[model samples]
Target chain A: MKARIKVTLKPGVLDPQGKAIQNALGALGFDGVNDVRQGKYIEVDVAGMSEEQARTEVERMCRDLLANTVIENYTYELAP
Target chain B: MKARIKVTLKPGVLDPQGKAIQNALGALGFDGVNDVRQGKYIEVDVAGMSEEQARTEVERMCRDLLANTVIENYTYELAP
Candidate 1:
């Protein structure tokens, strides 16, 4: 089993890093790069578990340490 | 159109940030947290563009700023 976790800043949040990337993209000649937001991804191997167990484990991971709820939110894809 | 980009450090790579999180989770009573990896997430509005165009745009963004290919890899989900 494997899982892919995505963590992102919620909407309406300020993303200075993203803004910097947006500007850099425009300077690099990649036109129509209308917007850019920065985020993180985590991939893990869930060797033993059902979908329910995996989800519960992942949710705990997110809330406890994987994410800073004050500034980030997360979602994950788990494949058995 | 909109997209979600997830960035993560490749496996076999040390993740100090993740280790820190894992420790925190354990301290907080989140048992069974075998591991934790930290990453970033970005969600953006793609107002207009086909999937191909958006992908090209995103790849450039990842290369230029969103991700440091030397140590990170990224994947994205786009919904039109």
Candidate 2:
């Protein structure tokens, strides 16, 4: 099975990377792009697991490996 | 309008950060995890646009701001 994890900075956090990207967009002539928040994408592959197991295991992966508990949040979905 | 963007390292690129996470997962006893590829997640909010236009505009935002095209690729879906 294949799973995708989305890890992001928590709300109320100041994302300097995101702010830098926002400035870059303005410089590139993209109009009305009000804001940008940057995070992380992690994809993992597993074998011999049911979809439910994949979700649970992958969630564990997020909490344990991919995301920082202090300042990040994560959500994941299985690739169908 | 709301959109979620996923940016990932292109295949064939060595992802050191991902490898580090994989090692961490192994240390944490996540069994049968074969690989990890790390990337980016970005969320943006928009107003006064149709879904079609949002897609286009957001794509521009991605190429212009959120993603580095040299070694990264990106995909996004609208939040309905």
Candidate 3:
């Protein structure tokens, strides 16, 4: 099974990278750009687990290691 | 409008970061992990554009600056 995880900064968290991107975009003449936030996407392949089990395990993985729960939020989907 | 962009490495590209993460996971005792790929997620806020316009502009952003077209693929969605 394959699991995809998206980890994003919680709203109100400072995102310097996002700010840098926004500025870079502005310098590139994409002037309409406003607030920007950057995050992470992770795809993991797992074996010996049903789809549900994979989802559960990956969720645990996110909570325990993949995401910094204090300032980030994560959501994931699983596929066969 | 707000847009979410996901950029991922093209298949067949060697991913040292992914390999490192996989090894780290194994060391952390999350044993079933197989192939792991890491990517970037970006959220952008734009003004003076309709949903369609936002999508078009963000797609261009991906092509020109957000993603390296030679080795990465990007997809995005826009929301009001």
Candidate 4:
């Protein structure tokens, strides 16, 4: 199974990197951008696991290592 | 309009960060992980624009600033 995960900063959390990107976009003459938020996209390939097992494993991975739960939120999907 | 963009390293490109994550998962006793790849997810809020215009603008942003193009590929979707 393959797991695709996205870890994003929770609402109201500061994101300096996103801010920098927004500013850089403005400087590059691209207008109309009001806000920007950046996050992480991770893909993991798991061997010898059923979909249910992969889901459980990936959820644990997120809680244990993939995310900083205090300020970030994570969501994932699994595919064969 | 809102644009959700994902920027990822092209296949065949080495990803040291992903390797480290895989190793860490193993160290944490999480097994069965065969491979891991990391990427970027970005959300942009555009003011006063139709979806078509937002798409065009965002495509340029991806090409010019959000993605390296040489090593990274980007895909995006727009939402109201």
Candidate 5:
């Protein structure tokens, strides 16, 4: 199974990297961009695990390592 | 409009960050993990643009600033 995860900063958290990108876009002449937020997208391949097991495992991974729970949020999807 | 973009390394690219994550997961006792790849997820808010225009503008932003075309590929979705 494959799991795709997205970890993003929670609302009201400061995102300096996202702000840099937005400013760069403005310098590049792209207008009307009100905001930008950047996050991590992770794809994991698991062997010998059912969908339910993979979901549980991946969720733990997110909580333990992939995200800082105090400042970020994570979501994921699994596929065969 | 809102644009959600995923920028990922192309196939055959070496992802050291992903390898590190996989190793960390293994050390953390999460077994059966075959592989892991990491990417970027970006959300952009565009003001006063229709779907078609937003799509075009976002594509340009991806090509010009968000993605390194030599080794990265990007995909995006737009929502009102």
Candidate 6:
């Protein structure tokens, strides 16, 4: 099975990389761009687990390592 | 408006960071993990554009600045 995790910054968190991208967009003439936030997406392959088990395991992985709980939120999908 | 972009490695590309994370997961005792691939997610806020326009603008941004078309693929979503 495979699990995909999307980790995003919580609302109101400062994102320096996002700000940098926004400025770069302005420099590149992409007018009207006002703000930007950057995040991470991770895909993992797991063996010997049912779909439900895989989701649970990946959720724990997100909490323990993939995401910073104090500033980020994560959601995941599991697939065979 | 807001646009969200996901940038992922093309199949067959080497991913050192993904490998590192996989090793870390194994060390942390998340068993049955076989592989890991990492990607990027970005969100941008734009003003003065219709949804269609925003998508087009972001598509161009991905092609020209945000993504390395040779090795990565990027998809984006636009929302009010």
Estimate every model's Cα lDDT from 0 to 1.
Answer: 0.74, 0.83, 0.90, 0.96, 0.96, 0.91
TM, every model: 0.75, 0.86, 0.95, 0.98, 0.99, 0.94
Q: Which residue runs of candidate 3 sit more than 4 Å off their true CA positions?
A: none
For candidate 1, lDDT tens digit of each residue in A1-80? Answer: 66678777887899898887767767877666566777766765554577898788778877876778898878888876
RMSD of each: 2.9, 2.0, 1.1, 0.6, 0.5, 1.2
Measured with DockQ on alpha carbons, how good is candidate 4?
Answer: 0.93
Error of 5 at B54 (Å): 0.3
| Rank list by DockQ | 5, 4, 6, 3, 2, 1
User: Model 5 over residues A1-80: C-alpha lDDT tens digits?
Assistant: 99999999999999999999999999999999999999999999999978888889999999999999999999999988
Compared with the true structure, what per-residue lDDT tens digits does model 3 show for residues A1-80? 89988999999999999999999899888978879999999999999988787877898889888899999999998988
Q: In candidate 1, which residue pairs get closer than 3 Å at backbone N, Cα or C atoms, i.e. clash? A: A39-B40, A39-B41, A40-B39, A40-B40, A40-B41, A41-B7
Error of 5 at B66 (Å): 0.2
**Model 3 clash pairs?**
none
Measured on C-alpha atoms, candidate 2 has an lDDT of 0.83
Better of 1 and 3 by DockQ: 3
lDDT of 2 at A3: 88
> What's the CA error at residue A10 for candidate 6, in Å?
1.6
Better by lDDT, candidate 5 or 3: 5
Better of 3 and 6 by lDDT: 6
lDDT of 4 at B57: 96
Query: TM-score (chain B) for model 4?
Result: 0.97
Q: Which residue pairs of candidate 4 clash?
A: none
Which residue runs of candidate 5 sit more than 4 Å off their true CA positions?
A: none
DockQ class, candidate 1: acceptable
Error of 1 at A45 (Å): 5.7
Q: How do the candidates rank by TM-score, highest first?
A: 5, 4, 3, 6, 2, 1
- Per-prediction share of native contacts kept: 0.53, 0.82, 0.87, 0.95, 0.93, 0.93
Please tell me which predicted candidate would have the highest DockQ against the true structure.
5
